[model samples]
Target chain A: MNTPNTSPSPEVTRTYRRLIPNTWWLKQRSTILFMIREWSSVFVALYAICLLGQLWALSEGPERYNALLAKSLSGGSLLLHLVMGAFVLYHMVTWFKISGRIFGSGPLSPGAVTAVNYVVWIAASIGVFYWIF
Target chain B: MCLIKFIKSLEPLWWSLFGLGGAIAAFLFPAHILIQGVLIPAGILPKDMLQYENFAGLLSSPIVRIYFLALIVFPLYHAAHRIRMTLEDLRIGWLNAILPLLCYGGATTISIAAVVVILRLS
Candidate 1:
């Protein structure tokens, strides 16, 4: 079969192997964003680990829990939390954006699915903030 | 490779956890991080937000405990799934063999620890 490859032997067929680099996601803006969205889950898990530690300390006693709180309120922790919060925010947005497709065209449109997710997310955030602060 | 194949066959289980965890992360994590991380730490909110007595009371409530458990547990699996897949994407040779066990196993271990902690909270 004739093809558009400017080759001396166009009739020859070969396998197509996807040779991608470790940093292949870096090649494009969308891929970079996609990788970041996927990769930031590590930090998300770290924060959960930290939360677990806090609970463990709480189970231990008030003294230990308060001490942990003191550390959590430090400048370093504030910085780390800021970073973690941003990553989680990104995770939320990306996940919800993709969440709409879960409905397909069955009943709710993709935009409706995404909108409902965002609405619920905002309500949950507000409820949490009210409970805490 | 029997063990590896067995784990590979459990992809749907891992994927289901990932979606559940993703939903939890989206709805809850940012708010907790914003309050516990940003507000209290920066002194924008009163310190009692994390006062041990208040927090302990919160933990005593079964609802809060369940919420905390969900918060502390599921996102871990979500993260583990992502991490394992990312390692696979990197095309590392030996890593492909161990990544699933290492990542999901780590998540399972931590989740168990969290449950123990919550169960023992007084």
Candidate 2:
């Protein structure tokens, strides 16, 4: 007995599915947002390293440390602060938006997970405020 | 666990507010003495220290240190989690375990290091 061919016909082209959604707006916005978030990490890391260096200087001696500190407080430092400040704000907002997605409860219940996230966020804000101020 | 999650959830907003507040203070109040007098001429910091140190110091003060630590630790946790998701989104399945471990491990190391420095300073 002859077997029938199962291969695709010559006129047909193979189709590929996208991992992400097909909405053009969503794809563009998400790509932009992702780039912002990823690059912001680098800035945050830079800020962390600067802090470590400050700590090192303070550990060394007063005069040297104070001078280094003074320089950062003046001139172009102000401008840099403005830029980093914006990036940091963006970072914070995006972080919160993504928080629920990261640690949400598995398929058991959806709203329950979101509720838990909001509660935690509010409580943390209160606690940090109390501690800081 | 709930309490921890609550704090974790609030972290990004809290940090954003704090960072913004600190940035404003850095500009309006202008810790000129701290930056120009101590950080700049002293010659130990990286070139960018001219821009970073004052804001960082303001954000990294003793009280702020606690906040900073929380922000650092939690944001990193958040980052790791998000990164894992992104990897999976991209169909990079094998890295799931390693990514989280490295992220949390690095975060913990940094937190410990910061704590040590803070304690030494105090």
Candidate 3:
């Protein structure tokens, strides 16, 4: 059975989308940094995995652990670490700076928040150094 | 009773881990990276500083074990969440149904592995 078509059509058809260009995120400086920050977590995860690998090596014995550490000290590993370090550091600083916005906006100043964040971080670093040394 | 609804309900949980992980990454990851990456390679720090025995001795403390747990686990979730979102942003929306499970599931598995390694170290 066929029924008569009942759908109404506008005289002029309109599509609603405002197409986002592939480069939309790259158009802004802040967004460029934002994408970098977002992408840096992969390196952080890689670092974590490296640490886990070291833990497994340590479990196997000092010989295996030392071998792993030596590999970590190799030129290739050092360069990889340096690249990852730069990315992760960028991630951390940007993350700290934007934390105020994450919690809420228009209450506490971001400057004050950033200052506090750095201060505590410095203190923690000092404590770690004291413990390690 | 679809997977999307299931994932939506867990949003808060993953987001909380994301926040915590971000903070911990700020705290420890950079310093370790600098030490292991630049300073040691540049010879500013002694190689013996990270020797297996010395590092093991450092990890022997229970408190340090907990810190290690935080360092390893939190960042897994953070990376998972970020990567999943980035994939979505890249127009892989059709995969959305399985993305959450794949991302968060991978993180959970790694987190468990990290916990097991930490316990062994302790």
Candidate 4:
């Protein structure tokens, strides 16, 4: 067995340790899923940026805003949205499943929290839809 | 040392933002995506609904302003955090010191811009 060096090794040249595989996340199903879930953020960030652009366009006035809106509705943007939407949907679904872990596992159970999450989500979205359209 | 400690202390802040953003993203983003991506594209929701006048009018409401602000901003920080973690998971250890700063800084800058835009929209 190699003995531990309690003292500092300022003068000693330490050998480089073997690095973790870049694909280490692929070793486990959960880790792979988590990585994919994390990837959803890229799309989220893209959409957020686009929305900010829309806000800027709104600030610009009706003509520019209309142009931006038209661009967003074009074929390219639609395809982008479909792809991004899939990722975001995956993100949302996984998030609901694990939200209890984030907020703290309080008196309410995870399942209950998830149920409440879905309920609130549906209600709020419907409310927003009504308010907006 | 103090600077390091300060940076270290930001962990909780980042984590909290990540959780909050995740919650918002899960709860509200789907509806927005469906409307903007599917309904609007398919013409089921008339293009007029997204017209400048209509959208601007919709955003003029205080509640809608707040909702849009939240919707646009939180996910940014959340994405930053996730991107940082994803990089770490990729075994990019050399970037440890700078990654958080870059990611969170970008998110902060954009969030501030978003807030300003939302505030000025009315």
| Top model number, TM-score | 1
| DockQ ranking from best candidate downward | 1, 4, 3, 2
Q: Predicted chain A of model 1: TM-score relative to the true chain A?
A: 0.79
Which residue pairs show backbone clashes in model 3?
Answer: none
Candidate models: Cα lDDT each: 0.88, 0.50, 0.82, 0.83
Docking quality of model 3: it rates as medium
lDDT of 1 at A104: 45
Better of 1 and 3 by TM-score: 1
Q: Which pairs clash in the backbone of model 1?
A: none
- TM-score attained by model 3: 0.87
What is the number of residue pairs that collide in model 4?
A: 0
lDDT of 1 at A132: 43
- After TM-score superposition, what is the CA distance of residue B29 in candidate 3 from its true location, in Å? 1.3
**Candidate 4, A1-133: lDDT as tens digits:** 4568666576676777787889888889988888889999999888888778988999888888888888889888888888888998899888888875555476888888878888998997897678766
Instruction: Between candidates 2 and 4, name the one with more favorable TM-score.
Output: 4
Q: Rank the candidates by lDDT, best first.
A: 1, 4, 3, 2
Best DockQ goes to which candidate?
1
True contacts kept of each: 0.94, 0.06, 0.68, 0.77
Candidate 1 docks with a DockQ of 0.77
- Residue B63, model 3: lDDT of 88
Give the DockQ (C-alpha) for candidate 4. Answer: 0.75
All DockQ scores: 0.77, 0.09, 0.69, 0.75
